[model samples]
Target: MTSALDIVFAALADPTRREILRMLLEDDMAVTDVAEPFAMSLAAISKHLAILAAAGLISQEKRGRVKWCKLEPDALRAASVWMQSFGQFEPVNLDAFEAFLAQELHLPTDPEL
Candidate 1:
């Protein structure tokens, strides 16, 4: 049987859902606003949102007539803890990972990079 963590990992596996999480990181947004940047239909975005909601990555509430989506940052704690367990094998150096990402993306390295 699939666990909640399994569901969350599945939801986060999608690039669109990951982007949605990033957008919500800044602030809550109306469903329409969340759908704006994507090329797909609102229905498609809603499907992605539903997956995220099920994963506990986000929560949706209706206020007035608008349905808003908010990021539940704490929801990631489980995943974070699971990832930390892997640290027993090797330490996670975020700075080095960031530099690696920059190199792979062909972005310039700097104090901010």
Candidate 2:
């Protein structure tokens, strides 16, 4: 059985899937609009979307007719946490860096962050 981490890595491996995520980042989009930036067929893009959805990177919802896709930001958090496990041997404090950025920007630390 494929682990969730494996699913995430596999989903992200495809350039097309990454671009699809980029498109979804701005707003939820129909499959056809998501496929517009690439030369691939709608079917191919649909397949890519399936991979992404399976990995929990995106979720699909149907409203009446067209299906729209939206990015699951929490899924990226899961992926980052998985990858960070490998870097446990390192000394860098990513949280501290994030706080430093927050301080420099004069923004309060994110509660969810």
Candidate 3:
């Protein structure tokens, strides 16, 4: 069975969908405004938007005669948590690494070299 995480990853796998999400990051936008920068037909952009909505990455609502799309930032919390878990290791210190390498190889650490 496909989990919500799977759906989110699948939705994010498409460049078009990723771009749409980036655009919506600034503010909510009308459906036509979302489609403005793409070369594809409105129907194709709608398909991308549908996938995003299905993944819970975006929410769509009608305002007056126009439909608007908004990014749901919380939808990414799961993915972000999962990804951050892999960052358990401390970041490498380049200077310390260079010193260790020099010691191991019996090389001088002089800046002139």
Candidate 4:
């Protein structure tokens, strides 16, 4: 069976949905307002919102005539925790890692070097 984390990760796979989450980080917004910056039609934005809502990444409610969307970050706790598990490893510097790789492969460096 699919877990809730599975759904959350799936929903976040889209760049548009990721941007929507970032927008909500500031404050809740009217559904139309959330759709404003995107080139897609309101219906398309609504579809993305639905996927986010289903993933528990966001919650929506109607205030008067306007439907507002809010970020539900609690849904991300599991994913965050899972990622933090990898924190035990030392952070690697890319330049050092690349040099190590070149040395291991006996690859020639630039003539200027």
Candidate 5:
């Protein structure tokens, strides 16, 4: 079975969807306004928005006559946490790595630049 993370990642896989998310970061936008920048038809943009909404990455509501899309920033919490777990490890020291490589190859380490 697919997890929520899987759904979110799938929604984010498309460049068009990622651009839509970036636009929503500034403020909520009408469906038409969101569709304005893209060269594709409104129907195609709507499909991308639908996928984002299904992933919980965005929320859509009707304000008067227009449908507005809002970024649900909290929806990224789980994905962020999962990704940050890898950051817990200490970073590799490049100097140490270079020294080790030199030693393994029986090369002399140059102290002077």
Candidate 6:
């Protein structure tokens, strides 16, 4: 079985997906509303939502004619516990986060090129 940490890592692998999670954290929103803030297409947003759902980071529901997304806070709590255990993750830094994303995405780092 994939661990909660695995779910977290998978859920956080995409920047747009992360933004979706943060938005859901505020409150559940319909699929269209969730996709409205981004330049991407509705399909792209739905794909991100699928990833979050697969990771158990969020849940989806249909009401009448609209589908909504909601955050699963426990998944975040699990991610936090893993971070706390590592003992080196201080206040979030943009550079560090970008580096982490690059690493995750397998981008060739150009330290000097």
| Candidate 6, 1-113: lDDT as tens digits | 87768867977977889778878878999999999999999999998898888878889999999998999877777778778887867668767866866755567776663
Model 3 lDDT per residue over 3-51, tens place: 9999998998887898899899999999999999999999999899999
Cα error, candidate 1, residue 21 (Å): 0.4
Query: Best candidate per TM-score, number?
Result: 1
Instruction: Give lDDT tens digits, candidate 4, residues 1-112.
Output: 9987789899988989988998999999998999999999999999999999999999999989999999999999888777778874334766766685575446777565
Query: Relative to the unseen true structure, what is the C-alpha lDDT of residue 92 in candidate 4, on a scale of 0 to 100?
Result: 77
Query: What are the per-residue Cα lDDT tens digits for candidate 1 across 1-113?
Result: 99988988898888788889989989999999999999999999999999999999999999999999999988888987899787752446778777756754466666764
- Superposition TM-score, candidate 4 onto the true structure: 0.74
Candidate 4 minimal-lDDT segment of 10 residues: 88-97
The residue ranges of model 3 lying beyond 4 angstroms of the native Cα positions read: 88-113
lDDT of each: 0.87, 0.84, 0.88, 0.88, 0.87, 0.83
Superposed Cα deviation of residue 7, candidate 1 (Å): 0.7
- TM-scores for candidates 1 onward, in order: 0.81, 0.74, 0.75, 0.74, 0.75, 0.70
Model 2: per-residue lDDT, tens digit, 1-113?
Answer: 87888899888887788778877889999998999988979999999999999999999999989998999978877778877878763436787778756754467776786
The per-candidate count of clashes, in order, stands at 0, 0, 0, 0, 0, 0
Question: Cα RMSD (Å) per model?
Answer: 3.4, 8.0, 10.9, 9.0, 11.2, 6.0
> Positional deviation of 98 in candidate 5, in angstroms?
25
Q: How accurate is candidate 6 locally (lDDT)?
A: 0.83
What order do candidates take by TM-score, descending?
A: 1, 3, 5, 4, 2, 6
Residue-level lDDT tens digits of model 5 in 14-95: 8789889989999999989999999999999999999999999999999799999999988888887888788753337678
Residue 62, model 6, lDDT = 96
Model 1 regions more than 4 Å off: 88-113
lDDT of 2: 0.84
Model 4, backbone clash pairs (residues 3+ apart or across chains), number: 0
TM-score of 3: 0.75
